[model samples]
Target chain A: MWEIARSNKRKSVIFVFLMALLLVLMGGVFGEHFAQSAETGLLVAFVIWVILSIIAYFQGRNVFLAVSGAHKIRKEDHPRLFNIVEEMTIASLLPAIPEIYIIDDPAPNAFAVGRKPDSAAVAVTSGLLNTLNRDELQGVIAHEIGHIINRDTLFMSMLGVMLGSIVILSEIARRSLFFGGGRRRTRTSSSGGGQIQVILMIAGLVLMLLAPILARLIYLAASRKREYLADASAAIFTRLPEGLASALEKISVSPIRLRKINQVTAPMYTINPLQNMKLAEDSLFSTHPSTLNRVRILRSMAGGSGYDAYDAAFRAVTGQTRAIIPPSALKTAHATVPSRSRRSDPKSDPGTDQTKQAPSAMGMAGAVLTAAVLMDAAAEPVTPAAKVRETTDAIWKSRGYRFIPCPCGAALKVPPDYRRTDIVCLRCGRKHPAASAS
Target chain B: MECPVCRESMIVIEYDDIELDYCVGCMGVWFDAGEIELMLGKSGIPFPSEALRFRVADTDARELRRPCPLCGKTMQKVCPEHGRVILDRCPAGEGIWFDAGEIREVIKESAGAAGDIVLGALRRYLGEALAEK
Candidate 1:
């Protein structure tokens, strides 16, 4: 195992070294082609590539967060989440605790990015926060920490930068050769420069091909071992492999699939974010290890047996694994729909309490915030239970029963007589149904 | 791992098949050395409403030294987050102990309550946007 790790690391270093060398060599060759031919257009284009890469590097994370709609959190805003993070930081011995952000998505997925532990940021979809119990959650958190501790986050971001840098440079050179230049410039060159143009043309083609190859190579080098490392580290941190193994089992079965993951960031997560994928088929181009394989390794370390004990068990249950669970419905008590439709009241079930609290708490605040965020109405928490009761009654009385202030936030309807029956909201189709049971 | 609060035998309880350490007596949980790190880092689904009412209490105030649940070596209370939630974890990468309700309480506090409000807001925002599942 150590030897495999060593050889892989050596290969990664050598591959990076070779890529850097090729770019430098490719740059020089391209430089000679342009200068000798004296094509003003190509020269200006090459300059632009250098300039843009520098600009994108500093602003990349910001650009991604904004376009992806990530919200930043201060410890005070969500003390519980922040406190847990605070706890994790001390235990991990990390140089920096990553800034936490939530992506307003229902998928139970998260990814860590930035160059290293000090520079990293970990973002989770709201769906993820709503799903796992604390122990399973800890297991997941440990996995992410494993990514950071192993330096995979930094590796990925840097690889993104490098890939971007190379592509920009390559494109500039290619376009300049064809279109002359980005700005107004001299077009025709002396016949003596004809040979140089041929070389420039050839280099442009090579660079184009190298662009994708370069990106893949970086992923191959950055991804493979780091995932294993994070898994091992997560097991080490939790000191209970079953926690993470169980987490993987739940995540595999979750309704919300990872939506934020793309070709660029797909490899950075513990599991491959792209769903409906088989590792054996996609591993050729992918950065993540197979789920079955990971589950097996975790199970081995966990020292116990369960549904995920063997690969066949996981494969049989993991039908189309990429579904992204929704967040908006998560806080609604009515979200636990299965319990609601059961012969008895959903609340009667043992699971309702855990299911209802998250959604209903959100349901109340969400209604308040929804009004605020949508209608531009400023509001605060309704402290008096009467205020809550009043809102619930008003909602109950309103025609169409459009809105529900139930702590679970499910849009509900209660027959005047069955008020005791507690008609819950239809399952928002996220998790189990009615969020109101608790 | 021995329960920090009780110095009693710790039992591992698997909820929903997810393993967690429990104290046989006090019901507090001491998440393994970095277990807190793991839990906090991974995002989870909503906590069941039934699990939310649990609260953490230092069940045993009498004793400090405890036997290592995994290694059988004597263990001491070590502050993981510096006095907030001390741990009875193996100094090595072995497992740790939980005093009965510790795991449940942490899960409840973290997964229940106000955190869900923000998560719900985020969930709606994200859920509707993707509209996938």
Candidate 2:
């Protein structure tokens, strides 16, 4: 894992440099064409790059959380989610548990963001929480932690910002050209070196138009491989390949598209929320490898839970000689596969009895018990409605909504900004003072 | 969420883990698609595939069209197979909007265990409001 992270960091530096060069070239060309000064264009582009980098480096995680409409939640708010994250953290051997966040959107998706594992935060949409069971949720969480472990989050953010800079620069250039900047350039350049200036201007215009697409291509090419690695890591961490396989299946087939996602942040998610699942084949523009391919590779893992098994599965499923996991990592990783049974099921595994004597075991047991009770209490056994309800309630609670329970068995959730003093129950018509209910 | 009818902010009312956005000003209710599914699925109610097969109702041409609260698009009016109630549904299938007393009317006219459960819950919680008229 450390080797992977080190190599990832090295690749990230190289990628950043390449993108920076692209930004500078684009800037210089645009500036030379528009301002008739290459130095000024170069300077402007460099400044934009630096400002974006600084913002991404320092406040990128918070910016992502805010933009995605994610609200930070304490452990008490959604204990199931927090517990799942915690279990994955311990399993992954992460330095600290990443802060958890919840997005209110019903589209099932999740992403992790941070410069480093210790400072990381993992956010899942309410739909993901509502849709997935414990094992599937663990699978998704493990994949995210896998990204954090491989330092993919940091690389992706920096790359995303650079991509943003290129897109913005090109957009500005395009708009200016569209709105009569071309006429001004032609007028100014017709004096001396007219032929060469005209040629250069055309070349610059072409570059400006292609820069964003070029940057996006580069960005997409680099990200797709890391997703497979994260999937492999998720499989290894959870020791349950089927869990993530099923999760990928569910997420890919979900009919609801994420409402808050845009192209730039779309690559950060477990599956590209912006991309149509039907068109999710390996492509130059895709931010992720095909979900079908990923699920197949995970499900095809023969026996081992190590990187070796994952590499073998990858080759077998993709029919490619090139290994996804590095040979060195494969050599170091011991071939050991844990039993595929649900590890969290206390009833199925009596080993939990021995672990229950430990202090932390109590909390784990309680969470499991609570989950069990909730699942059992549901009238329909398969829908996981109780879990969905709990997840949504947690989201509401985090948003500072005051929960007022009516004697008639209806719960009234008054928005924090609600100025009304009284709320009439929809089920029983009992009027309750909002301020006094709490 | 703002009410589609009155444009006033609505409060959430939850029963059986299902949340409905209730408008105080218009006495309307918004049932989110996902939440309704969860609620129905929880109560062991089999949601008919054709239940939400909404078509543009031509009879309510004189009525003002309301925008969907979830997505600010003009909602299409649809009359369900079991009821004469003309409900507003988002074109994007975000949810259904019940105006004023439309929920009770739907409950009274609709048949099956699903309607019974919904009606019983509504009567228990909003007894006085539903009893009026």
Candidate 3:
């Protein structure tokens, strides 16, 4: 895990430097075009890059939180969520519990921010709190905490600010191009310096046009790798990879899109909120890996939810012998094989995990049927947050409960203490016949 | 904002930055048009086309119709196609009114897409027989 953080830091430092260089070049072009001097342009661009980096380093997280409409929440507002976050903080062994904030939008998403774990903040949408059960919510929080522990939040914020500048600079340059940039400065008719100036202008123009795209591609690549590491960390923290796998499945398939998230902040989210745009899951432009692929890897873990198990599952599913986790980390890793092992079971093999998890022909037909039912139901939530919480106990029991639909549309909620064979509906005074399981 | 249902003065409850008006008597909440749009917008998801318009020419609506507290016009009864909750939207684009428990239903419906995603995958991969087992 430390190796993952080290590698991410190394990659991010390189990425940030490249972005800084791009910013300087953009600044130089703008300065040279306006001031008509090569040396002055480079100096001005360098200054601009430094100023922007300083601003991003100091206040980027605040700007990001404000832009996302995140506001701090007292523990009283949502005690359950607060407690879960507290639990994750301890599990991740952070020095201090990060502050929590909530975004009122119904989209289920969460992200961590700030320069370090001690100063970090985690924000979740109201929709996330309402949708996920306690265990699933814990899983999500653990994932965010993983990002904090791995120092991905600081790197992500820095990248966002730099990329933001690139986009802004490009926009300004594009406008200048359209507006003719205050009339091209006329120079001496036959000079080698003038020829160099023209070449520089063309080069700057080309860089300005391509910088945003380049930054975005690099940002996506960096973000996807961090997401995998965060997932691994989350598994280790929760010691229940299935929980996060289920949460991801829910988040990816969610219909409600986050309202405040844009391209700049999209990579910070647990699942890319823009994914509903229906880009190919495996496309390079995607900020996160395919949700199905992530879930498959998590579920395929044979025993302990450790980094090694995740790394092994990752390789097995990806069909690559190369390890995702660093070799240095693997040396000290715990190897846990499930106690109830079946060597002859083909389905249990890592090599065939994907094949076993892949959708069957009948399942495709079933999905179509499910989609139709969903469309008819519209986007209405089938279960309330409170009710979902009730089912969370099923995770431990490994048993399902049957709901007896009452005439008044409310289900007869059989409490754990209910001893009668017939459960009374609270909404309408109707008595429904139910199994006396409670 | 006063509750259209009970006409009682509403108390403001702050959830993050969103200040929602909740009626003390009826517990119905009033959300301004801008607030609704802001919430919908920030969620980074597109709003359903049907919910955008405040007033429609066809006025015959469901029985739960109530006057908009701000405009005094009979609010249109809107049942989101995907939701079982019936929300009262103002004709003048002022705001929408949600009865006490309606919002919970709407939230649950908002989760349907995710539910489908999880259930769909499980059904497709495991098959009904194995899934049941």
Which candidate number maximizes DockQ? 2
Off by over 4 Å in 1: A1-15, A32-61, A74-80, A116-119, A181-200, A253-261, A275-282, A302-438, B1-133
Better of 1 and 3 by lDDT: 3
Stronger candidate by DockQ (2 vs 3): 2
Worst 10 residues of 3 chain A by lDDT: A367-376
Q: Would you list the rank order by TM-score, best first? A: 2, 3, 1
Give each candidate's fraction of reference contacts reproduced.
0.00, 0.64, 0.00
Candidate 3 structure quality by residue, lDDT tens digits, B1-87: 456876654443322233345554555667777775455444554544443333342345555668998888988877666555567
Please list the residue runs of candidate 3 whose C-alpha ends up more than 4 Å from where it truly belongs after superposition.
Answer: A180-182, A188-198, A277-279, A333-438, B1-9, B12-133
Positional deviation of A322 in candidate 1, in angstroms?
A: 30
- lDDT tens string, model 3, A321-410? 987776655554322312111223334443333233334643432221110111112122346834333223222122122335444444
DockQ of prediction 1: 0.01
Candidate 3 is graded, for docking, as incorrect
RMSD of each: 27.0, 7.1, 15.9
Residue A234 lDDT in model 1? 58
Best-first order by DockQ:
2, 3, 1
- What is candidate 2's lDDT per residue for A29-140, written digit by digit as tens? 8888878788988887878888998999999999999999999998877887888899899878899999999999888999999998999999999989878877889999
Full-model lDDT, candidate 1: 0.49
